[model samples]
Target chain A: MDERMTDAVLATEELTVRFGGHVAVDRVTCRFRAGELTAIVGPNGAGKTTYFNLISGQIPATGGRVLLGGRDVTRLSVAARTRLGVGRAFQLTNLFPDLSVLENVRLVIQSRRGRDFDMWSMAAAHADLAEAAEAVLERVRMTDLAGRKVAALSHGDQRKLEVAMLIALDPKVYMFDEPTAGMSVDEAPVVLELIAALKAQTDRTILLVEHKMDVIARLADRIIVLHNGALAADGPPREVIASDVVQEAYMGKALEDV
Target chain B: MLKRILSGDMPQSRALGLILLAILIGLAFAPFLFPGTRSLDTAARICVFVALAASYDLLLGYAGIVSFAHTMFFGLGAYGVALASDGMGRSFGALAAGSLAGALAAAALALLVGLFSLRVRAIFFAMITLAVASAVAVLFSQLSGITGGEDGLNYRIPRALTAAARYAEEPFLGMRLTGKVLNYYLVFFGALILFLALLRVVNSPFGRVLQAIRENEFRAEAIGCRVVWHRTAATVISAVSAALAGSLYAIWLRYVGPDTVLSFEIMVDILLMVVIGGMGTMYGAAVGAALFVLAQNYLQALMGAAAEAAAGVPGLPLILDPDRWLLWLGALFILSVYFFPTGVVGRLRGR
Candidate 1:
């Protein structure tokens, strides 16, 4: 990875998001470097998803600022943030169940292509849009299932389709939450390969929240550990995993349940 | 091949072309097949309800928000036309402006309601809308001066095509519209145009994001979809459609009243049409409307003799009356909920 790419694609300055009385994420500051795959690892309730939410502008931060390419976007709406080149994929699959895989990708591509409000022209006539969606499908290895309904796809394939959707947006930064949550051991490697390939091919920054340490160790260029809504450790995988606090956070009897 | 066609990957243009062709053929030949006052009247009524049903589907089916207050918008449009055109002697343009005013008013009301109610999901949202509808009905009943109260407002039929003919100096398209046939074609064609426009909107990127919001709002927001805006837009669009249907009803009946506009029956009928036809599918609205009208017509005919025979029982209300159709409609709703959860057409499509 280029050292200049570490100038930061997305950065948070003491960002805090509170839900009623409980603080979901507390004064967490971090920077996602461009062209690098960064992993946020923590147990359940550690606020990894909430942090993602704040960065993506899905939810407003109670305190501090979210900077995208050095521009403060704390008050921006989700769509506005998307327009600024932030793409997100949810932990649970969010594809339109009735629409086919190709249509799902086509919708994202259409939005990116800036023809969302075209009422008179037939969307099917946009051969370039279809080709763009097809390219994303091929990237995710979902070209074979493009014609199939998303509901008909297996759990792993659906995840790939979700990735395809994000790819169609061609966003500068991608935030994925639990990308391989329901995949089998055999299927997990395929997704890992896709993510690796995505990182190698594009200068886009990747922020991932994952539980599978092996997958994290394999893909993460840097790892940030969150425990109880605060950053516990930050460094390379070897350095962070060896920290006593990180081990205690994971191996503690009470924490083990999470 | 059928699976591929039904998969929604097939461009909507091709499917829409076939549907439009079918509708054009049907509209062209329908007058000759029906050739009678009763048949024409039924067909016109179907068109009116189809438009109303399609609007309701836009909200409940596609947007996944059940709004029982839809009939309030419909009623407002009817009353606006009555008050503006009939009461004030305004022209067709004024009537249209009045209808648009009513639609805007409904959109404002929906925005207010959605601000609080949209926070609640599912049955709670439904209850809130129902409360709004009931409250509106009560207000309309109490405000007799504006709504014409129970007696309703009766007036002359507004000249729809005659003005067009006079302006263009066309010979009324060679058909005397003094009968119901012309009204049927007019409403049917209007309904067709509205349906096509809605189909385009639903297939657009805007509609896809709205569906994504419906599926998972939080995720959609995370992905940069403005969930509130999309939902509100859907509500406003639905209100406009309902308002247009209301104006058409006022024109067709040559009357407007609190009973016609503010009735719980209209809301229930719209719900039945969307649910029984299919929720979410474009054609579900038309299918539901057709089935509902057909069932009502036949059921009333069948129950007339039975009600007459049972009239000697003294206290029993006439089951043959159109008002009594609610009971059967409620039964059908329950049946649809249990057996055909997705709707009749939805079940057939195996969705």
Candidate 2:
């Protein structure tokens, strides 16, 4: 990883999202530094997911701006934003369950290669896409299950496949929502290792939304806490964890439990 | 590694191959089984419904957009063909013109409707399509002069085909299509071509993008897919297919009426067919259409003369009437939703 974090890959300014009468995300400004892993931690219904959604363009913000590498992208569509090098992983595994693991990655490769509209040509015939898909799967240590249908894979494997798809996009920034949501202790470490490996390979910025403090402590270079649609604290993990506001937000719950 | 293919594989390819073989055999031998004029007519009618159902499947099953106004396109095509060929005194060119007009009309409606309805999910979209369908029906009913009022338009056979038949002393080739076999084959071949074309489209990258949209529209949009454009393209393609089927219906029936064009029954039939066969599978449309047509035919046959006299069965209760087909269809729809959520093909593929 590059020692110099000189660039801001993703920056949010007064970002807010509202659903009808309820404010899901309040005005918040934050910047994700390049070559750093940042975690967005919050209690349930704290708007962490909502913030992620706004930044990723899953839902348009009611007010505020989002910038990707100094370029304003508040008006861009989700797809346009993605093409401009922003990738996201959903909290719920969003995959073509019937497709093979390799086919899943191959689809991302196809999109990246700009062959998404070639109707007459077979996707399987694209050797470069296949190679890139395979390489990403190998990076995630999922090559052995490449031919297996996504539906047949274990939850952990499916999560790995999701990460592999994000990696295939080769985005300048990756936003992950609950990356270790349903993993066993052993499985969580594997995913953490994979994320670390991704960080090592590229100077890409990462915004990880996680409930697991251990994973956050191990992976996050900086941490932000959200409580009821507002920012509770922002600092390094140790400082944020020790903050009185964050502890109150957790209702005196231990950081380990969080 | 070799064990992978034989042991625990989904067997999608094998299943698809078998289904394709079955369809090929059925299409090849349909004329032999339905040798009479009525039988051939029925087969042609089935082809139109199959195409309509397939088009519906593209939007509802594959793209996950529940639309009830698909019949609008079908009706438009039917009326367009009738107006061009019969009313306007045009010849073979009327077919192309009618299809293009219907598609453009439907595409325009889809764009307008999709703009608002696409923002809402599931039930809202369904209700919006229902509203559109109902509105169109009312509009056509009010426009009696252009739409031929309640009596509808009477479509005459093209002069060219009759002249050709007279010139050749037979129908088209030396083969006498004085029967329905020729018409059946013609429509069946058209449906087959459409089915194959759709199969190719669904398997390509373009198709993959649609599936991606279906799986997660937000994720798809984030990945650089223009959600509205992709959806609009699918809608237009589906509308064109429905219009083509409608044109075929107009040609086969040699009559166009408001009842056939504006009825909600056509929409229900298409939906039931797709659901019964399977959603998201290529063969689902054909399977659904076949099953629906056969069931209706059998039920009507069992009802016999009494049903024809009053459009209601004599021996059975009111539930067995021709209109009561919806009750049975509704029951099947519920059962399929509960027991086979993925439909027959989806369940088979699951195993």
Candidate 3:
């Protein structure tokens, strides 16, 4: 950890990835500070998820590096980065489908508790973890569904389970890639509300990748626009959302119909 | 008491408990109740196969890893005992030394194979293990000086385990108090301990992690579970268990042969046992092994009797011939699968 608390919690320096002559994230450098939500907005194929992957160690960078608290972590594996406090919620709701919701969350607690290698004791012996996991589920208003299998859960509940799992992990940085992508319109706000509650704590950094402009406006304190795999605009929500560069690059031929 | 014994993993179904209980009691007293060499041999084979199939389930059912190299580990234990006994003479010390060496070697080989292949996709792992296992089987056949080549080695066990060594001058309850009975007890108890140990493992916290990795590999990794590390550890454990089962077999038979342990057919048999018993349940191994081994030993004879009774029927004798026992075995498996899709244990528990 960096001694200077005022410093950026996470910073990427000219992070670039080229997939067979097609540059995905092109020389993008950005810094994210604590107590703020930075939303990365762009059109499809604009490298939003790709950038998240590099920062969370999902995919490696071809050029430059990712620094966590001024420490280089570009070569670390996904599990190593997760251990270093980089929590990631997938775009497609990646979770243990066969396990019950409580078990799913309990496993994360066990992993964090460093008891994943305890081969002698039964899983049910750790009653404290089950309680703690239920508390996390409580936060997401999913206590009723905790005993049910994740495979039987609706898309909305599955997304909520992902949040509960993330909470159990308690990582320093929260990286949510379109947390409500496939959720129904009625179910989207519940997850967005959970993200909002986390942001209100004002002690953790959250990086969100979303396409909904209204969502970006309401949740994002700082907005960075990506166009054609390059950073086109970076500023506070007010100025960046109105910038001519963003409108031209992202809005996609504004006023063609009008 | 049962909960503590099972490490909090209950059978979860009354029918499953009864079936498993029947299997446990049947094997425990085979010498006294059956009172025949053939029945005793059948019971001992059931025990050995139970342990072997349970070990395979640890990989296939819990860890969700497909490994063709399992029998290779089984062979290593058999050969370890056979060669050590050959050199050191027939003694319990030789058996113990061979068993330990074989288990260690199996663990080491599993670690190597897991490291090289577990990192890739599941299908690639299946392919790699298939290739490696075939290579080892062929090597056992070619290593004439050490492994006894294709004929394999028929070695000796301790004198106390042989039929000649009687425990007493008089027969006990119409049964001979011979060393063969003592040896059968050794095998039965050894298998019982192994099965219970596997039960303890599957209900443990580490076993839950294996189940997690099996259910969702990507999420397990994202959740800070070292997928490969956990998988490799499981592989090593499973391999060691299989080797121990092979040691029990060597002690009982006083023979170590490639076809007995290293052949691909044994690997397929193990797969069948795991599937028929239920992949994830340890008790399923016992059920699957007992069912398959009994069908193998007696199904043909039963078919022979049926063939004689049906001799007058057109084309019925040919179908019922003992030579076509495999055809009936295939039909039995298909019917079991159709009725008990999750294997017998899973079906019992699902209710």
Candidate models: Cα lDDT each: 0.75, 0.76, 0.89
Write the residue-wise lDDT of candidate 2 on A1-258 in tens digits.
232323678888899988899988899888887778988988789898899888888788999999988798988888888999989888898887877888888878888888887765544556888899899998878889999989999998888778778888888888888877776677666677878977776588998998777778788889988887877788988888888877776635658465
* Per-residue C-alpha lDDT of model 3 across residues B1-351, encoded as one tens digit per residue: 888888887888998888888888899878888898998999999999999999899999999999999899998888889988988899999999999999999999999999988999999999999998999999999998988899889888988998999998988877898999999999999988888888888888899999999999888888899889999999998999999999999999898888898999999999999998888888888899999999999999999999999999999999999999999999999999788888999999992
Between candidates 1 and 2, the lDDT winner: 2
- Flag the better candidate by lDDT, 1 or 3: 3
Which residue ranges in model 2 land beyond 4 Å of their true spot?
A1-6, A16-27, A41-47, A92-100, A147-152, A210-220, A223-258, B1-33, B160-185, B302-344, B347-351
* Candidate 1 local lDDT, B1-351, one digit each (tens): 532232232323444345434644655555565555566566666777878888888888878888888999898778777777766673667567667777777778878777777767769988998899888888777777776677777765446533222333332445334534555566777766676666666665666666666776665554555567678778877787888788777766767777777798878888888988888876778778877876777666656666777777865545545467658766767887689888866666665
Order of candidate numbers by TM-score, starting with the best: 3, 2, 1
Interface RMSD of each: 3.6, 4.5, 0.7
Q: Record all residue pairs in model 1 with backbone atoms less than 3 Å apart, i.e. clashing.
A: none
Tens-digit per-residue lDDT, B34-99, candidate 2: 454555556666677878888888888778788888998888888778877765565667766766
Tens digit per residue, CA lDDT, model 1, A1-258 = 345435988888899988899988899988887788999988889999999988888788999999999899999988789879999887888778877889888878776766655544445667898999899888777788989988899988888777777878878988888888887777677677877877996588998998877777788899998888888888888778777788776535533332
Q: Write down the DockQ of candidate 2.
A: 0.46
C-alpha RMSD between model 3 and the true structure: 2.5
Residue pairs clashing in model 2 are A79-B221, A79-B224
Model 3, A52-126: lDDT tens per residue?
Answer: 899988788999899898889999998888888889888888999988999999999999888888888878888
Report the CAPRI category for model 3.
Answer: medium
**Which candidate, 2 or 3, has the higher lDDT?**
3
| Model 1 ranges off by over 4 Å | A1-6, A18-24, A43-45, A58-60, A118-121, A211-218, A241-258, B1-32, B88-128, B158-181, B305-339
